[model samples]
Target: MRECDPRIVLGLHRSRYERRILTSALDLGVDAIDTSFNYHGFSAHTALATAGSDLLPRFKISTKVGFFPTAGQAEHSLDPDRLREAVERSIRDLGRAPDLVFLHNPERSLTGSSAAAQDRLGMACAAVERAAAEGLCGGWGISSWDPRPLPRLVDGTLPRPDAVMVRAGLLAGIDVLEASEALAARWDLNPSQLWGMSPFGGSATQPLWGKLDPRVFIQSPHDGLSAVQATFRVAYWLPRVGRISVGTDSPTHLGELVDALRYEANLDNLSTYRRLLCEQRDRQPL
Candidate 1:
């Protein structure tokens, strides 16, 4: 087996939940995977258990809660009791507790006045925190697709997460990047305590990847790197997270991502790019 690489997390949000990919991840040294309670029609945990009950123990699994099934449609909720129940159910479905459990886009359910929003977010975080304390899961985190609403809501009183996962990549934009950093700082989290998700903003096949030369973000002699691979490498520095969760069912593609890590990032280019992003974009495009 290949030695485990701590940096790459196989995000199962878009996965087919196949056994071969799980085996491939282990063989490729990608020993971590991130999923959500609501993924794959809320059958993700069960499917994972079914596909590779034995393999689950080989990987460090991270998953999200807060979204639940309702009347055949998924709905977001921050109710403490409901959140705790989700954690319990996830353990039952997966046949094991996840290594880390994220609050899962808490922003989606945070609405109303600022004070009210803060209260809701804090209680939800506490519920997961309690689950972790009770051994319902190994640890707790907050995975935010859009982290803008979070930094402001975070303060000393809020229950800090073991880590915070946010969007990272050329497409992450300046606003979310800064917000993720700010939130981590408020919680006194170091880089290793921060994580990145959706490095390609959900897909590597998007038209945008083909148009840009992402190698600019990497220190040269990297002419051999593919633009897609270059983008994955640069994602590590985009928001400066320790681990990044990306998805793919193909083992070859997964290997390509692991190989991209050999190239070092061009911090100067990344800095300049961030400056330009700050100058032009104050908000993410709708």
Candidate 2:
């Protein structure tokens, strides 16, 4: 799966290209198409909704929140009213409701004291409930880059959605896979339900950029090629992880990405790890 911003087309002027991309993407035969609540001034959303309709019989649509920078400020609060407004706007923007509406940072709702946490949890739950009521999403879920509160949420202490989208990959070392496995076993959830992100992190640029330094979350010494392979391999085997979405902001990377996925599908664990290690080791100066 891939998460792309239709707005990356610049403005309404380049809409023709965006439209073509959307049309092409619909027929790309991918298993899913993901849109974001903050994608391309709502036009992309609308375009995707329409394009998705054409491929509805073949693909799943996953939409998310949690990076809406309003006036250059990052917004992470899961306020019910805010979330409802977002959904409504997204529906209007996309011209239809998505198959799934994921609360971008449900964990953000727990950043305060107990009372504040409760309030945030309530708001998040309300958001899901409202989405369900509106028939906006097939099911609701939470997307958390942070795992601090995930175990609790999935353990049933917190509100549970039909799924949980997480950030899992090599940058997290083995813990990435371990945490996911633990969650599945603990909650008895399927393996494919886990959604992974940032498999390469910085490993998307150069020899020392997107490389396999799993210990560095914010930096990568590997290239995007290595990152792509590593991520796809883990997600493929991570049991309940239904989809693996990579956040590649540039269109230039799309072609290489598609090729990588094609090659990735045929790779085994040993091959994947060897490639990651080779990239990492290569990054080390002789």
How do the residues 1-286 of candidate 2 rate in per-residue lDDT, one tens digit apiece? 3554221111121233244454444333344556566555435566655644554445456677654557755666676777777777776766556677788766765865666665667567767767876697777776666655555444454555676666654454444455556655555666556666554444455564444542222123234544544444444443336555664434445444454443333235435664676577668898
Deviation of model 2 at 18, angstroms: 2.6
Each model's lDDT: 0.92, 0.55
Error of 1 at 222 (Å): 0.7
Give the TM-scores of the predictions, in the order they appear.
0.97, 0.66
**Residue 56 lDDT (model 1):** 90
Least accurate 10 contiguous residues by lDDT in model 1: 277-286
lDDT of 1 by residue, 1-286 (tens): 7889999999888789999999999999999989989999999999999999999999899999989899999999999999999898999999999999999999998889889999999999999999999999999999888999888998988998899999999999788999999999899999999999888887899999989999988898996799999999999998999999999999999999999989999899899999988868755475
Residue 244 displacement in candidate 2 (angstroms) = 0.7
Off by over 4 Å in 1: 282-286
Q: What residue runs in model 2 are displaced by over 4 Å at the alpha carbon?
A: 1-17, 40-59, 66-72, 114-119, 174-178, 183-186, 209-231, 238-240, 248-286
